[model samples]
Target chain A: MDELSLLRRIRSEVDGPERAALDRGRAALLERAGAEAGIDARAGQGVRGTRVRGMGPDAAAAVAKRRHPVRWVGLGALGAGVLTVALVATNVLGFAGWRGGAEPAAADALQAAALAAVENSDPVVAPGQYLLVETDAVYGNTTNTEAGDYVSYLTINRDKLYVPADRSDDWVWVRSFREPYASFNAEGEALAQKSYDEEVAEADGVPELLRAPDAQFYGNSTVPDFDALPRDPQQLLNYIYKVTAGGGNSADGAALGWIADTLRTGVAPADVRAALYEAAAGIPGVEITEQVANLEGSTGISIGRVESADNSRQDLIIDTQTGALIGERRVELTDEGWGFPAGTTTGFTAVRTSVVDSAPEGGTQNGQFDREGCVDKGNGNFQC
Target chain B: MSTDNEIIERSLHSAGAFAEVFDRHARTVHRYAARRLDAGAADDVMSETFLVAFERRAAFDGSADALPWLLGIATNLIKKHARLEARAWKGLVASDLGRVDIDAIEQAAARLDASATARRIGGALRRLPAGDRDALLLYAWGDLDYEGVASALGVPVGTVRSRLNRARRTLRIAIDPGAARDEEVDHGRIVSASPDSL
Candidate 1:
């Protein structure tokens, strides 16, 4: 059949809005229309947020959450104005058409990984069990001194998140940090050592544990509905493009990074993971960067996209055999920006997820987990 | 039986008169919004579209039919949640199996093919450029003609035609790759030849 008729037939399946929805909309409209006409709309209404602007209650509740800036892990606020990248590096118009000149190797590998994900079932977190995710990461930490020169070093972070199957139950998080190595010269090394010493001293007697009491499916408010995510590969890519719009140097790079970040949570269901892999296959410039990649001992194939702006590449390593995201890494392709040599690993994270019976003790006992304003860092520290 | 222009004009003086416009077109606006986003978001969009239209009723362009203008407003509102709309389309593409309505024998044929065709169309719709997608959807789902689409998108009639052509061409390719590849290639040469001629 022709495309237009096909589209019509497809859309014909969508039932119109329910009567209640129409009534709610009409009521809201009438309330506002009345108020604007100098009529009082406040008769018999017990107490509600002033609908002077006609905002529904849900919109009102979403306002606070929406005001909090959306943060993508591992990709801090990337400034704009780097719009011109290779056609393959941006998802704006590239790869929108059927695989027009995109590397086939990456797409093939990702498709295979997606199929593997569907075959392997997700770990069922039965009632009374906690899904424990342990992650170890190394990130570049830099601090500028009064003298104008900056000291750069790699900081090591290790954290374990214990999420009960019952979302309302208490969730525990424990984290620890240590400096592994400092690069960029003698002065940078000395400064890194000093900073680490101070952090250790300050954290003395401060337990690196936090507890969230009765969090409604922790991170639901922050994380979009994973189950509701589009499962089709092309549509999933479109969805990712929408979420990661204007995020990083390259939109495609940011999307790949976001997938790695979401997977690092270790909470995404198997179907979502499969969809994510399938979606990643649709991104241009996503290629098998490494055939046999090893991160912290675990081995997997590394799929990566290079950011043309900074000459850095973000790599997500996936075990094609099992469809598991083993690790993620950022490699500085050139020394132009960070003065790091080519192939220098600027940052990397290794993830391990398992179901645990209990959470470790010594956290802030019964500290109510605050979802407003503070982010639920898998690492115990909640950065506001 | 007052014209939409008359209702909107009178709504300026009598605020309650605006409800007539809502009563007349709320279902249409809601359906269009539901087609773009989900029903949940459609409620907000429907209510807010009317609210915006009511607040700006003084600016009504005195058309007999307010659907084009109302849809224009709705298109803008839908742009804000373009991501969610794409997700919704993706959802349709991913799960379109048991939703087909097979009532009769002829429809059964279409119904059997509906699942695959729906997925292909859904994928094509999401991938179309936002402007092209909007124009095509306004034409297809909103049941707007060329002039009506132009009015809704606030674009020239020629632009709407060209966008529909481009969008339909893409969808055509997605639905029947073997057949449309030659057409796309021929069109590509013509497009590239224009630069050379210049």
Candidate 2:
């Protein structure tokens, strides 16, 4: 080989150490860059600055507060309280000397009224008229676009008088679903409302994708354009509350109050709780066996029944105030095609729904109700 | 008790400790970059190279040294900023113009053997295709191995070898056309085959 060719071969051989060195150098440089970028690489390392660049300080603080152990413990305690109530309501505790098969006076009265409502299929608004309606009716499967099949479930709730501005008196129906682990504001009130219209608007020019069978669409798409519908203020309020609650937890007294004030032009706690319970009972697979004597002081409700399709027994604990469902444990026999041969325990928390109710007065309003009323001040007003 | 791996692990986890890595390898990287681009461009390129390497540090395999990886990132960045590199070369050539003198030329000629060696190396490099030229320079001047050149070019080891071989052949012709003939004979002997007797 020529002297230069020989030299080149030698050079190639010598380059390995140099290449390794360069690799080492680059790795070190990247570590420094990560540190400068404010990413915590080491476990158990807290972020040094209170503020991060793109996201503000408050957002960072919120993340830290959400991750705190003490907060999680408090939520756990709340879950335990709801569980206790569920056990008591299901008569698992047997505390009130209430035994089975006597046809309790409360059940007899509610059953008779419920059966009458189902037969009439007309709205009833009496103060003590609680109805439990069961139907084989089909509900819109938000997840399945192609599998549009009806499922059987029970419905319960109070019927109220609705007097829209442009229509005659009509019965406005309201119901609440149980949601567990719902987020609340500092004042212990649920923040269930979507604060802005833009928050729900899809970006322009993006085609909507088909939802999977297991996925749910919880945005503005599910809400009805009630403003265009002619109805009384009370009817509008009931419709608005039903639409806002979105088949989720309606147990939050504040959420109920907001609905009451928005549609009825008034806020009543007793009416709100009654509406919430009705909504909870309307959910598919939900069955209300008995109404406890004092619902106001009750933390939550427990229901036991065989699920309609699978005939599997399930127990559910629902938060009474927040309408949040918790501690849902289902046990199935006969090896149904679904996995969980041993059955499964699931914990569910309520996610904030993206739908927001526009103020009836053509301005923005907070979707939450405090103690006083709807709290609709003007445009862009949010409950503190 | 800190082992080598422990030190490296600690350095990987902490950015402040990376200075030790820099203090150890920066001079060599600076020199390599200086050879590829001008000093000013090299500084910026080196900084950026390290910055990118730092950002992707989690992907590092701790068993290996990290210098070649840094150089690979630096090489890519240099390619991205090609115009800056051209300007740096232009400036280098322009500065050479100011130092040109008749006496200096005579003195340089008097040192023909040494000048010839440098010119031959440079001419061999310049004759190579841009890709091979880069591979050759990184290997010869930067002292990177075949694997290092492959890493820098993001190519395979065999490709590096082929490029290096082609570069050396081109260099031999440029340095002395007669030398090419000698190389063909030597290659034939080494491979146990005649050039035309295949």
Candidate 3:
């Protein structure tokens, strides 16, 4: 044989070690990258802010040098986070044991959640009556190094009111406040409250300073006709995957995101809500976090996926005892080299919906209360 | 349906996108590392290579496929274990000595023998300059063309040809001194320069 041909044959022999190498490499690299992406979205409020921050390393370096204005995912947080899962193929009503690799406590929790959802009656909304959705939604916490003195922490809360726009494809958004996770400047002034309809309307790209009779809101893009969603779990999961495929999220991520999005709308159809929970049981990487989410003042258990195309986990807070969605949170799993630190709550949407006749004037405001669902935000600690 | 570059672009905006990049190229990069190092160290080196690739993905040139870039990184990291590679080569060459254990059934299908010559080639490879060896191994093992080798080594295409020529000449001399001849008249070289632009 030719000398060159011999060399080629010898080189080909190295293929022996490749399979084992790929197996080891894939697990480690993917875990870190995958966790970073999924957890960031789940934990942080600033989706755009997080992406923009990742693009600029200088911003991360700036935080690293400082005392780190935000909180990070600690061992305690990870420890407290329940990696519990429950699987039942036939019926969540009573068929226990491992139909899949399902944990009993987690399984019971889900079954109870499903049962609660089934028993709870859907609130009736009449014509001209608004399905008032009050949420202390923190999009994300950004260090306001732009300002001085005591490091003013800014976590812009989206205190919104979603009223149907004459029962059509459109909806009205009345953002009542931009409550800074801050304290009083003077006596009788709890916090600097900015309740401007124009600012909220403009932020949502409504163009008008005030809500017009006909204007499309930013969040209206994801409003689904629940009547069309399948009643079956696997079918619903497929539907979510198919529709959201063109978007950024993975199939697992899409399912998690869709559930949160629908619940936040504050008008999830009763039938759809039950089916959605059942469907959630089938998605891989989903776990029951031991977090009792506080939505303004109410509480619920967090059950959702910690997977994403980014560095955060998206959790849906539902009352296992009552099947009501309390709120949703995003927990950052890895730093994503942005140096934000793991376990940071990147973004959160705390939802509380109440049916009311006729829209309240100026909109419903955030009262003297705190929203502590997953992580503990002690008094005066306003940001992540 | 997204290309690696497209997936990387989307990964910048979304979390799952980066996983797609890993899914596509991790195996190729891993096994390539195994060729340079033992299977155990290859696992670690492959992990390190990808982690570096992911961290620096933002600076990645969007027009290129990530495999050559990834293979290049693997080559650089593997350079640290040059001694391990040398030992592996020497041991394999030694094992090739006085071995006539080719099965009758296998021999019936096999047409020729090149183990001793290949063993000499392997030792000769271990003795080349790190850059030249990188170029050679990339060509021989990376399945990279001239352009790919160049890009992987961060050298010019012309330089890649020179390194390959030099690497091949050294091996040729070790195998058959008279047949080694001059580097200029190696017109018999079947190297596809077309892939040099990759």
Best by lDDT: 1
Compute each candidate's TM-score over C-alphas: 0.47, 0.32, 0.44
Query: Chain A: TM-score in each candidate?
Result: 0.68, 0.22, 0.56
lDDT of 2 by residue, B134-156 (tens): 77667765667677677667787
lDDT of 3 by residue, A4-107 (tens): 45455553545443443444444345434433443333322322222112212222211221111112211112211112112222233311112342234454
- Return the candidate ranking by DockQ, descending: 1, 3, 2
lDDT of 2 at B135: 73
Distance from true position, residue B63, model 2, in Å? 4.1
lDDT of each: 0.65, 0.35, 0.55
Among these predictions, the greatest TM-score belongs to 1
Give the per-residue lDDT digits (tens) of candidate 2, residues A133-235: 1111101000101232211111111211222222221112221221112221221111112211221231122211211111111111111223342233233
**Best-matching candidate per DockQ:** 1
- Chain A accuracy of model 2 expressed as TM-score: 0.22
- Which of the two candidates, 1 or 2, achieves a greater TM-score against the reference? 1
**Model 1 per-residue lDDT tens digits across residues B63-129:** 9999999999999999999889989777775234334545677775775466566677778889889
Clashes of 2: 41
